[model samples]
Target: MAVSPAPSSGHLPRTSPRSPWDAPPGGAPDPWTPWAGPEALRRQDPELADVLLAELRRQRQDLQLIAAENFTSPAVLAALGSPLANKYAEGYPGARHHGGCEVVDLAERLAVDRATALFGAEHANVQPHSGSSAVLAAYAALLRPGDTVLAMALAQGGHLTHGSPANFSGRWFDFVGYGVDPVTGLIDHDRVRALALAHRPKAIVCGSISYPRHPDYAAFREIADEVDAYLIADAAHPIGLVAGGVAPSPVPYADVVCATTHKVLRGPRGGLVMCPAELAGRMDRAVFPFTQGGAQMHTVAAKAVALGEAATPAFAAYTRQVVANARALAGELSQLGLTVATGGTDTHLITADPAPLGVDGPAARRRCAAAGIVLDVCAVPAPDRPGGCVKGIRLGTAAVTTQGMTEPEMGRIAALLAAALREDAGTRAEVAELTGEFQPYP
Candidate 1:
């Protein structure tokens, strides 16, 4: 895809006038002031409060490109910091193992209901603390110990929970691997089908953390059906796009779907599991007694807030702009002679090897960070010849887009990235200037 030309002045369109706080809650502006308790904490422990405030300042200043990260709304943050964090709800809404559960029950039910509605799933478990836990719970719910499972390979963008040898998912289950075609950098459906038939695995896991294209969930479902394997879609990265109706949902095809609330969903840092009605009981049990003890009610409440925001038309526009910004970034990078994996992005992330610029992934990441552009070192597919680890840097526009950056901003960012790779001294100042204009949480 070609990079869209920016205006002659090199400026992009401004962000939407609609602010998240503009909407009235319950048809009226919230009259209660945002709590000033943080000030009390600042007075009580100046050092710790300074650390928290410093982190917020850092987020406000840096150009965050981390694919796995995003900025949650003030409402979500408020809920996370609420007193519900004091609760110890050890079970589901109606079946808690502790007292004083009435209010927390409402929070969890709201989270579950909103999540189900967002994803069009029959049931949702909002308790898993992170995406890893959600993936583990899904495995526990469907597969017995040592059951054979087929999943995408870690080096090719699959997450650790999918089957990294270091993770419990690999230790507990017999896992076989698949990868994207090296030349195309896309999953080959024929290869997946062949592997499923050959391994005869108990489960097939789809979805990825770094892949920049849309997943073929239906193809995975067809292969799963042919081999009688349960299809698990770990959509931790694209859940917001899926919810916003920009990306195809895995719910209609997969037997189980797992996601984190924080990524593009812009919720608090938490996880969710969704499955068919019949699997709901097992999934709930796996999440509660099997993987976690008590539910994090505060985070659940925050997720409820995010789900509510995601259901709005404004969020849909936000998510679509996220994709547009990603494509612009990828296209601009490629136009500047960088090799963006899969050519360009159809999603919010782009993986580019900086080898052409005479640096490895880690070195490039350090350079970018020094310039105040935050991203991560990632692996690329190496399907043909033997080489050292195929290292690259992964970038995402979710955070920047949330801050209202658009295509011209993407062009500026791409130039900064290039200058960063080249170790140009001026890049840092340029990055700081750009970040100043799109201050997060402002």
Candidate 2:
């Protein structure tokens, strides 16, 4: 590969994105945004620079099917790598414990304002370190250590924080899990109501990691009310869709909504929590003094940038295309003999069993990985029989959609995936050829 140096042009030359496809959300654009890092790092550490270049090549070569990943815009990237990373603001804006918190305070305020407006919530806390951390804060704000919590079963699509024994949620709280209908692959509301009545839990959580449909927020709210339980929505995956108005907003239904800025939101890898005005103090304190310390100011600025971008009509179109692409992939993959969980998806994610193709989930994942079609495997737990489960692969369209691929490309990806699972050695080159036409970063 040949290398060329970026001119030492001042901020005046870097005003706006050259094209709407790579446009920055409106504001004073980042003065230092670059497709790659500044030339200084390449000159200072060529070894580390090689690793970064390799990652760039890999991203451009492989299909990123992981549901939890996306390419942040260069503007967001600039914010994440900004000087705000040097700050140590240990509390909410306007009330930080640190002395020099004035400038970062403005960025945090903007993040909260944009987040609340984007999701139609009364309050927002853009501070928790990750989705799991945000979940922990929601718990700290609303539940006691020994309190009973009713949530989706881990084996049935729930996240680890929904009460996996290996996580803090399970060790500190009593968890009663409600599962989906085995045949339909959808949450059985009757079962959820029954569990709530039987347990009388302090809180009822509504969310999942791999389930392909929206959780019935209204129904969950009703059940929580019947049981006098607080409704906590761990909306880590669908929050971006919510922002784009492609999914139902849980703000009006759930008592606290915990989410990640990174996933479909395409922000920095961090968390945000939103709630009604009454719970604002508890949520803020929970994110700060309770579960975390200083906020990552750089990430906070990046989140603001992403949220602003999400508020645009362009991002809404992007999200719609994401779901469209997911549906196309699901339909084509199922046609190729994989059993798509829930028949298809109402969101950007799809979970499919590859066993009909003569490959289990892990094996299929390896086959795809070898051919550069990266993805993850998940289990669809069956409660009727002891230890009964279905192994499956989980993937999403956010990243590819961000890269501007649509349903036509989705068809090609499906064919390539099926070919890989069938041990076709030519799949790798085909994948590279496809992704090469749709680079992640402009």
- For all candidates in order, the CA lDDT equals 0.88, 0.89
Worst 10 residues of 1 by lDDT: 28-37
Residue-wise C-alpha lDDT for candidate 2, range 85-140, written one tens digit per residue: 88999988789899988889989989999998899899999988899999999999
Question: Candidate 2 has which clashing residue pairs, if any?
Answer: none
Task: Summarize candidate 1's per-residue lDDT along 175-254 as a digit string, tens digits.
Answer: 88888887898998899999999999999999888899999999999999999999999999989899888899999999
TM-score for each predicted model, relative to the true structure: 0.91, 0.92
TM-score of 2: 0.92
Give stretches of model 2 more than 4 Å off. 1-37, 381-386
Provide the RMSD of all predictions against the true structure, rounded to 1 decimal: 10.5, 7.3
Q: How close is candidate 1 to the true structure, as a TM-score?
A: 0.91
Clashing pairs in 1: none
